[model samples]
Target: MTRFSANLGFLWTDRPLPDAIRAAKAAGFDAVECHWPYDTPASEVKRALVETGLPMLGLNTVRGDVGAGQMGLSALPGRRDDAVSAIEQAVSYADETGTKAVHVMAGISEGAEAEAIFIENLSVACDLAMRRRLTILIEPLNAFDAPGYFLRCTQQAKSLIEHVNAPNLKLMFDCYHVGRTEVDVPTTLNKMMPVIGHVQFAAVPDRGPPDHGDVDYRPIFSQIAGLGWDQPLGAEYKPGGDTDASLGWMVKFR
Candidate 1:
């Protein structure tokens, strides 16, 4: 059976984190994930998780100073210390909340120096995450949604993972971004499965619910299962209507 994770970051924005979690459980989701829950008290989030018996799949490191247009710190030059601090903070949060993984953002950076900085920062992150038995994931965002973002392609992410050379480092293969940034999503997914730690989905172009996307996820789900991936597929889409109403596609999977 294909399990689904409701990404609380996109869904249930109108409610509190704990309420969102409860909603996911009531909505028949197998698990939950989020973008950043740092603002919420850890004790409260933990209580919700315990109450619902749902695990938080993953969360991202802070997008460094979002108001300043800084997306992430990991690849920014002269921000190596800041990057490591962010990773450490995320790992600590994961440890407290029982989140299984952390996606280290690379920010809006480029060039060889940025790549090198990313590798160095990722190595440090992997080390910290490994100690907590948490997987460290790197996701490739599409340029359209995240222009100037340091990581924008799975191939680039793969190469960075290779360079970092950490067992705990893995890819967060977001099918939506793949559909937007690259061709042949199925082939790319098949090629990258071995290194994938998590998977997320949303509609291409509009970032809406998967049921209305250019990519047909039915066969894509089969392909993932064919590769023996047993984790829940994250629904990281913006609701076209009510978040609850947008979950009609989930009926087939359930």
Candidate 2:
């Protein structure tokens, strides 16, 4: 069976975090993921998870100072302390909520110095995550959607993971961003399977539900399954309308 994870960060925007978790459970998600749940108490999130009997596949570290235009903290130069603090916070929440992984966001930064900071931060994150037996994921966002984002391609993510050389370090492969940044999704997926820790998807160009997009997810999903990827495929997309009403595309997978 192809398991799916509802991404609360995009879906069910109208509801509270706990309610969204319940909605995702009702909508047939095998698990759930979120952008940032720090605003909501971990106990509340954990209560929802326990009530629904659903596992949180992953969650993101806080996007440092969104008002100040910080996409992430990990890659920013001279922000190692901030980056580590974010990781520590994420791990604490994940540990409390039974989440399996945390995606350490690479804030908008460029050059070798930025990359070095990211590696150092990730190394620290991996050490911290290991205590909880949790994985650390780094994703490559498309420039169009997140201009100046440090990580921009599968190769870059892979290289960083290799450089970090942490057992817990891995990649969060978002198909929407991948489609926006690279051609031939299947080829890229195949190339990236080894390092991929989590996989997310949305319609290309519009970032909507996965049913109607330039990228065909049926074959892509098949390719993922063929590659022995058993983790839940994250449904991280903008619901064009009611979150529950926009779930028609999930039937085929269920």
Tens-place lDDT digits, model 2, residues 183-244: 67889998998899999999998999898979988888988998998889999999988998
163-237: candidate 1 lDDT, tens digit per residue? 888999999999999999995799999999989999999887788988776898889999999899999999999
Which ranges in model 1 have alpha carbons more than 4 Å from their true place?
Answer: none
| lDDT agreement with native, every candidate | 0.92, 0.92
Find the 10 residues in a row with the least total lDDT in model 2: 245-254
Q: lDDT score, residue 51, model 1?
A: 99
TM-score for each of the candidates: 0.98, 0.98
User: Which runs in model 2 stand beyond 4 Å of their true positions?
Assistant: none
- Give me the overall lDDT of model 2: 0.92
Q: Tell how far residue 84 is off in model 1, in angstroms.
A: 1.4
